[model samples]
Target: MTLRLLPLLMLAAATSPADAVPADDAPQPAFFEALRAADLRLATIAYRLTTANAALCDQLQPQIGMPIHALTQYAPAARKAAATTFRFGATIGVEAVVAGAPADRAGVRANDSIVEIDGKAQPALPGTDAPENAGARDAAEAAIANAPVAQPLRMTLLRDGQRVPVAIKPVAGCRSRFEILLGSGLDASADGSVVQIGEKFFEGYSDAEIAVIVSHELSHNILRHRARLDAVKINRGMLAEFGRNGRLIRETEDQADLLGIYLLANAGYDPMSAPKFWREKGGDIDGGLFRSRTHGSSKARAEALVAAARDIAATPTRPIIPAVLATRNVPLR
Candidate 1:
């Protein structure tokens, strides 16, 4: 799956953008326009965070700075629009290449159909294409991730019916992939290597506010919360919010909340925006099932963020790596 997670807000299935808009399923040019806009915004923010804080991560990825879309991401009926808009064949297309990223620097352009990666031919996504095409997209990333981090990826693009060759020499960044689940719930999650967020947030949040949420998820990975929780063997079932399970879960959330603000500042974002987001949107967005004992209240989180930002502002350290990062080697309290 796409691995879009909201640590304490419960898990929701990842849905494709095309799958989410069944009613407006017609092939309007605006469909891809809006999707690309959101994708680019998230990509830009993620690029900033991962690169600025690479010193904090133990693992690294060849940050290619591109988002690819598989034909399978669109429903059967919606594939034509994608094919036309992106010039699809039996291959995936470049959704967007982050400016100055490896892909963009190598002359890769949007809508370019990728036919091969490092001399290995990439076939079209299997079957008629399903909404859950994240695995297929991830496979393509695996091809790159498998390559040596210090080397560049030699790729062949079918542009104007000509097989074009290019090399994307990726830079070392935090080992993380950022993805957006189209028409997904109010959820954001971070696995060790991937950060997934719901596109719905674009409607409710500005790019800065969205950065707050994205930074929070990235913090979860930076802190290695999932692996730690798993190793400790905490009960993560429906009853995760009770007893020691609840305490540990909440601890992770608190750690993420604090470090997330630091990450924002490290990335050149306004750290106070973290507190501003929780103060304004927290009470509204975090209501209903989104609320959890594993997370602090909106008022509490915002206040805490305010205090944290004050500390970050006063400190003269660059990047300001979290001190708790060292304690992660010890067992959770």
Candidate 2:
């Protein structure tokens, strides 16, 4: 679930009026294309890395697949009307496709506008008066929902001014989804079903390093941390503000670090990158009071990851499960 750019807009509004650029000086379409490129690239990398540990995902996830690896771009009506070369219908266009995924294997290519599903034209999605780019996604989701697992889903893509028919066969996966949020801040979180990444996190990190962070968030989901904490009668509202009951949060963070290393190794990624990333970027955000409460020191996290890597190397054949905190029901640090 990629959040809209409302937060980015609000951040820009903080600058002085004189510092603000004119409305006409707003970003160009090519800028959006650049973001789209980066967004898709990172998403592709993440999808491949996470799905590499398909067996583990199969064990933990309830529903295996069907949310295929296809990133979408919804261009507005004004942009479509302004283009001189060719015009596109309000349908959504494919921004990226994970290699060897159902969509990729089915011959769907980037820039292809999804026109119809199973020979039926997609109905207009709610909340949009004008033609929308989400119609294709809505239709695709509906098609996948109705189609049985491993069954064929026929779709018509408008490519090169022609409707190219293709059939995609859905397969099983971990059920955890990935998305990129367009913003400058470096952050990511797993909202139960999806891992939402901020684009800023992509900068200054290699693909392997990014996988470490992603795996950590994915670990949170796998362990059902949010749900588990709630079940234990932990007051989430208290922890969200002023760092109350922060030791509990820190315990979860430690557990996530240990499990994240295992996840990285399971996915055939460099597990060592987990500690290295914490040593570098993780150190930059350490040392505030709130940070101490909500998260352990960077050094502590790196040390835990190091131990986790050693354990994984020692037992190469076994499946790694989420770690349980040593002490629970502790006072806030």
* Predicted model with the maximum lDDT: 1
130-199, model 2: which lDDT tens digit per residue? 5334444555554544555455778777777787999877554455656666543566777666777666
Over 248-319, each residue of candidate 1 has an lDDT whose tens digit, in order, gives 988988998998998899889999999999888887667542456888889899999999999999988778
lDDT of each: 0.76, 0.57
Superposed model 1: Cα runs more than 4 Å off: 1-26, 124-135, 288-290
lDDT of 2 at 297: 74
TM-score for each of the candidates: 0.87, 0.75
Error of 1 at 107 (Å): 1.4
For all candidates, the clash counts are 2, 1
lDDT for model 1, please: 0.76
